[model samples]
Target: MESETYHGYNIWGHAIQQHEEPHRPGPYAASGTITQNNRVIEASGVLGFFDTDEGAQQAGLEWARAWIDSHG
Candidate 1:
């Protein structure tokens, strides 16, 4: 999980490793959440999947930032 503050809102990015098959590594699922004053403003289910954890997390963060930009 990674977090950042944007436009006075807290944005959280999450990367969840998935195991779709045995003896094979699966993709990482990306998700994001936006909060203000400790309350959830918006959240995403699975944005997409990526090969690396950092990639997934970065995707999530970018999604959250975009959401904020469009909404604000």
Candidate 2:
């Protein structure tokens, strides 16, 4: 993925292509990133992308909910 700036945050998403269908890897997979003063942070598994960010978050949240339901 190319370096990109999002919302004045100077962030870039390091999106990796999956070798399967939907042509995308579940919104959050390998890694996602943001930079500040040359320091990079892991936004991976956080669903921070413009397109699938919501879906990614929903996916994770659903997993969490299911865990609670199963346990409690």
Number of backbone collisions per candidate:
0, 0
In order of appearance, the predictions have TM-scores of 0.88, 0.35
What TM-score does prediction 1 earn?
0.88
Q: What tens-digit string does per-residue lDDT give for candidate 2 at 1-72?
A: 434444333344344433455755454443345555676533446443324544444444443334334544
Which stretches of model 2 miss by more than 4 angstroms? 6-8, 21-31, 46-72
Report RMSD for candidate 1. Answer: 2.5
Residues 1-72 of candidate 1: C-alpha lDDT, one tens digit per residue: 999999899998999998876654447989999999989999999988778888888888899999999998
lDDT of 1: 0.88
TM-score (C-alpha) between model 2 and the true structure: 0.35
Colliding residue pairs in candidate 2: none
Best candidate, TM-score: 1
